[model samples]
Target: MQREPQVVEAKQQGGSKYRYRILAMLFVATTINYMDRSIIGVLGPTLIEHVFHWTKMEYAQINMVFKFAYALGMLGMGGVIDRFGTRIGYILAIGIWSVFGMLHALVQPAFGFIGFCMARAGLGFGEAGNFPAAVKTVAEWYPKKDRAFATGIFNAGSNIGAILAPLAIPLVVLPDGTNWQFAFLMTGAFSFIWVLVWIKIYKKPEEHPKVSQEELAYIQSDVEEGEIEQEKEKMSWAKVLPLKQTWAFAIGKITDAVWWFYLFWGSLFLHDQFGLDLHGLALPMIIVFLIADVGSIAGGYLPKIFLNRGASLNVARKLTLLICALFILPAMFVPYMSNQWYAVLLMAFAAGGHQAWSANLFTVASDTMPKKATASVVGIGGMIGALAGMLADFSLGSVLTASGKEGYVFAFAIAGSIYLVCLALIHLIIPKLERAKI
Candidate 1:
């Protein structure tokens, strides 16, 4: 039997922080990922619905197409990344999504819903690889303990993308000469530049010239002494689906459904409830996503503090999630708040809580699974999450069609309480963050 490698006894090791450079790259890719996905959301009410004269149900149908495609994409992309490795897999994903994002600008009201649906579907498929590849990369580059913080740092890119979308999309409009299509064209083109940088810079830690010996040692510090480092065999969906750890990640990801709603609908929610136009939404949306940015980093670090105090990994991760769940509960009352700022504050809390919760939840895959299975496992979880988002989008559309802004009362309530239930379910499923026997 192979012996586990003995971990270095020294708690501290001085090293170059080259891993952070990789984290920065992941951050940029994720930022572009969201910028492309969210450009539509930021413009949904102002451009897609109002300017194009589509109904709420039509808008929901378009979002449903994206989420459904995202769900399927996650399932496929996870395995693709596992097989192809992050560098190539990530590049492929971004390349596909960027093309589709730019294609959105080419569609006109003449082509109508079918044309938009096709573009959104393609965008969702390509965007699905972002997390699976990113989480896998983190597993490859960082130790178990630092993974969450690193994930949090990079995950904040979503918010940065979200934040930038509202601001940048408007800037691209040519005043009297152009429209929303310009925003899609500009954001879609931005990713190709990042692709060039990523290709030149990214490589496995051992192979990269920029990574120093000290950093390599620190990166490998999690491996126990005498452990055999064999190449991991490819994991199949059949083999991975039965594992409780996979479900824990999946079920916990239901919260992302709420996030998807926030991403696609938050601006619309403001528009419906407060009569905010596109220009009116810029500040509030920025504030909301900016708060989430803080939550992502804070959530990532909060668990580390507990782990440092000698708590078990399970305790540290779950406890942070529980706190984040509580933070989101107040969001349920936003519909009743009457005061717009008060409602915005509650939404901020929920968004921040979700980000914080997400940072920890995403780390769970790498924490409990082998590196080879990391992307596949993340893909499995993300697929389920996207499906959940699809259901939420469908339901919200139906509800809003019937009740208008009143429908958000139901949506917010679900968003607020769903995380606590998910946390409970995650605990019931995994109980402890044990490595999969497979």
Candidate 2:
């Protein structure tokens, strides 16, 4: 007695399991991507200070340079990946970043400030492609219904990298005072190995021989008829750039970079302010980042809970992000605390909240754009964000130098509260976060 449409629906429901498998490999790729990028940050305070005798302000200046290079890199990588698709573009990105990640081991003090900054800058440029490609791939693989969760899983790789480095870096050694350098080399080798695995595993949705027809229908069916009717074909940035939605994503992405830039460099901040040794809270960023991983998925999923209960994705995403942004309030107090655990707890909460906000922010890109341009738009947004980070670092670098270790209270306070303020400004421009016609 079932109608033809009913029978088709049942058939479509038959192959839901394969979707998660496709998402799993993408998640692995992202984790490795973040891991390689962060290895240098962990080693920066200990190795750089020991070898080069640089002040905290000098290190801060170098971080600012990395941010500038990374900003340009994201702008370029997005365009390249948009034209070429994720496979070839991602392979190039992974290979370049990983090579330089290991290249740090070969660097000596004689290579000095410019050489180290160049190496970090090179790493930043290559690492720039990661988000755009990963976000684009998730759009290709998962249905709209599943995309938020998929984004959370893959995006959490940055945290996973932060987590793993503490354990992995401490394992490597060299006869010289260059044990940290060897850690960079080991991580670089690890990324190169990941390149092999990524190539073996990735395929286009249509080309994936193992993908069930049922799942394919599910993915295609989720593409709204409105999206199909307006412009089914992919458009370049020239066509997409004029839209307000693109700008919204750009603002959100820039805001996102601000939050994570804080995490990536926060270790350096603590090293300067609190005198945390390699054995203390400094190296435990792995544990700190692992805890934050919970926030990434939770932030993504929490909004869906609201949506399933009838809230708009726009409403749920922004409201939840506001909550995440507010987590910085406590972090402002950590720098002033006498007890180290208080500082650690405050930093953990702030980082975890940022990860949660990150999960939802990325989902906004996929939510507001076509799958084809999700990464490209995210790249544009990332470029702006990288610049914002440089500005923040440049200002903070001066503060650190003037006040010495004690100057961090202002840094933590300002960094913590930026998200709530940024989100408010962004919403004013793109009130509904409506997807643009591209």
Please state every model's RMSD to the true fold in angstroms.
Answer: 2.5, 3.2
How many steric overlaps are in each model, in order?
4, 1
What's model 2's overall lDDT? 0.72
lDDT of 2 by residue, 1-438 (tens): 122443546877767556576566667667777777676567667665677766666777777777787888888888777778788888888777877667766777886677778887888888888888888887877665567778888878778877777667656743123566767766655666767876886777767877787767766665666553333354477866777777776776656554655555667766766676555544557556876788778876888787778887778888888888886567778777777666777777777787787877778888888876777788888888888788777777787778776667776777677777778877988888676665
* TM, every model: 0.95, 0.91
**Clashing residue pairs for model 2:** 163-286
Model 1 lDDT tens row, 192-257? 888998899898887889887767776777754332253247778888889899999999988889
Instruction: State in Å the error of residue 247, model 1.
Output: 0.4
Measured on C-alpha atoms, candidate 1 has an lDDT of 0.87
